[model samples]
Target chain A: ELQKQFKQQEEHAGSLQASMNTTQEEITQLRHKHTMVKAAIQEAKWKQANLTRRVLKLVSAQEIERKRGVPLDQTEEQ
Target chain B: LMRQAAHVNAWDQLLQQGHDQVQQLRLTLNNVKTDQSRLQAELDFIQGQQQELEQLIEPLEAAAASTTPAQHQG
Candidate 1:
């Protein structure tokens, strides 16, 4: 009976060790993926800002042309 | 006629990649928040699970002009 109990304890300990190993692996991968997502978010932010500034510059140039073409004085006289 | 009507340039094409930024946000949000049918894996460091996620996600959701969809699931 004592031998049987020792055998059962060994099996339980083995399974617990395996569980811990797998959980550790999971946590490491979790951190890796978390870092990746954060990096992607940061890149998206800068890219968006860069693209937006370019767009705004284009709009500003168009506004200058419009103001030049449509003089405020001419409209006021009319 | 198409050439005059269409102002296609390398700069314009480069700026068009901004579409990928939108897709990246969507993918990141989905990665953090699972939808439907089990299989939800959350960061263990944060306490109160979904509550912590709400705090983390609020700014992004606010920027997108969309309110939080999942109030509970923990």
Candidate 2:
């Protein structure tokens, strides 16, 4: 009876170890994916910053040109 | 016989601990995945905004480039 109980427990331990291995692997993959997502977010923020700066400069230049009363064709030739 | 029972009990305890660890790890993984999805959504939003801003800037850039030299001449 004791041997039987021991064998059952050994089997239980083996299964538990197997499940732990699988869970650890899943966690590792999740962490890697999280890192990639963070990097992408950083990249998107950088692009947004650059685009905003360019838009501001362009808008200001357009305003100055409007105030100067520059003719469209003359400006185009320039 | 008693020693064998003790050994089995120890194994049971270890297995229970292992199960708890697996459960905790699974919860952490789920949270990480959720965060990953949220960040992805944020990235998409920022990229979309950036695209719209770029489109708005294109015509302005063209008009500015054309006007700069005329401003200089005047």
- Give the number of the best model, judged by TM-score: 2
Q: Model 1 chain A: which ten-residue window has the lowest total lDDT?
A: A1-10
lDDT of predicted model 1 = 0.49
- The alpha-carbon deviation from the true structure for residue A57 of candidate 1, after best TM-score superposition, in angstroms, is 1.1
Please provide, for model 1 over B1-74, each residue's C-alpha lDDT reduced to its tens digit, 9 standing for 90 to 100.
34532433332343334335444544654564442112222222222443454465555445333322221221
- Residues A1-78 of candidate 2 have per-residue lDDT tens digits of 877877887888788778878877877887787788878878887887888788788778767767766677678889
Residue pairs with colliding backbones in model 1 are: none
Which stretch of 10 consecutive residues in model 2 chain B shows the poorest summed lDDT?
B1-10
Q: Pick the candidate with the highest DockQ.
A: 2
- Candidate 2: docking tier: medium
lDDT per residue (tens digit) for residues B1-74 in model 2: 77777877887787788778878877877887787788788778878887887888788778778879867997
